[model samples]
Target: MAVTSAETARPLALVTGASSGIGYELARLFAQDGYDLLIAADQPAIVEAKQSLEGLGVQVTALQLDLSKVEAVDELYAAAAGRPIDALAANAGHGLGHAFLDQDWNDIMHVVNTNITGTIRLLYKVGAEMRTRGRGKILLTGSIAGLMPGSFQAVYNGTKAFVDSFSFALRNELKDTDVSVTVLMPGPVDTEFFERADMLDTSVGQSKDKSDPADVAKTGYEAMKRGDGDVVAGLKNKLQAAMAAVTPQTALAEMHRGMAEPGSGKN
Candidate 1:
């Protein structure tokens, strides 16, 4: 992480998974709005991300670490060194594709840890402090994918299901407080997500049509600022989320399989 002054004169916003994709875009919004940044990601590419954010002229500190570990979250909080956080974008998450039975246990566990455990841990740590401060905003990057049962991408989607549900629960819990929790449930966006999840060969992955990460981030950022409980990133995704509420799980699972099944894109 780049060294900055112990305390930034500007507001501070911490964004995770910020090396690329929606996370990076969210960080840009913060920088543009004159907030100093603390960005973290599991990859070394975060160092480069910091360099780019520096061009935005606000103090930027980047931490490269695996947020899936509880200790890492603690370390991240420690790095903040008592600085007040004005906004938190808890967006670090991973996904796994293919049949659950065939997936490696380690991969499945990683998905659960990164998507669920790490997210809650960060939220709790930051949220507690924010509650005391009486002001803060939180944006959690959940997924429209969570609305349906992912047949081939079982573990990943299951974890997101937890996130989607947890977001609302947390929001309700914080309703009386000044701190706000908003969930961004986006469908597919053109990011490294499909490749990282090893779903590049799937139909959904191959589709040229997908939401732009910048647009999705903007939607979430705006919703968070307004203290809205949640925002689905696209009209199609909003419809999907609505449908999921009434659709039977068994049918949804089959529908997901048609898009995510191995080599489904090749057909």
Candidate 2:
């Protein structure tokens, strides 16, 4: 496909964690919508994905960035290089599960760095730029797990709670501006996320019946376009989130056991 004039003339979307999962799918959808793209991920697959996107006739720039480094957040903005970022999709993150205090502190901090601090910094930078330009959309990948306490996945859940909560508050803050913030809350996505998190031995990791990343990304894209504050990706997740609201934290934690510990129980 030739680059559409509509695409060639406008600022493009910048998608983080774009090598795979919902990020990759969102990048494809954004390209389809005639947006040129800047896709970044620490994984090598990001390079491959960039080449593939270029074949679709949209201009694309790729970067290998590890958000956990903290400095990478500013470096990403530097890579933007004064281009108006029409859209920002901050979808790069990982999960950390197990008894909270039993886990390595380094692992815990890395998770916090990637999911919380790095994300907030990126949001602050790009969002401020968007506000000055008076227009932009932001999609934050949160998790339905954030709705309640998570036992084995305690720290990961805490991070999502922050993201999901922060997204809504930020949306309200940006309401007067041309910027809109949307949070994509998905559960049990069929991404390589679990394996990458070293959670391949768990039940959530082993589940074959996970939601497709493409579908989840579509939901996010639609929600971001609509300027919705938060969207739970699947119906089952919506129900789960709803239930978590009324259910006690203790009960919710117990219910979350199976999904968190895939290889945990007796057959």
Model 1 TM-score on a 0 to 1 scale? 0.97
Q: Which ten residues in a row have the lowest lDDT in candidate 2?
A: 1-10
lDDT of each: 0.92, 0.87
Query: With candidate 1 superimposed using the best TM-score fit, by how many Å does residue 30's alpha carbon deviate from the native?
Result: 0.7
lDDT of 1 by residue, 114-218 (tens): 999999999999999999999999999999988989999999889988998999999898889999999999999999999999999999989998999999999
Candidate 1 residue 4 Cα shift, in angstroms, is 4.8
Model 1 worst lDDT run, 10 consecutive residues: 1-10
For residues 12-130, write the lDDT of model 2, one tens digit per residue: 89899999999999999999888898888889999899998888888888888889887888787777666788999999887887778778999999889899998999999999989
The reply for model 2, stretches above 4 Å from the true place, is 1-8
lDDT of 2 at 9: 79
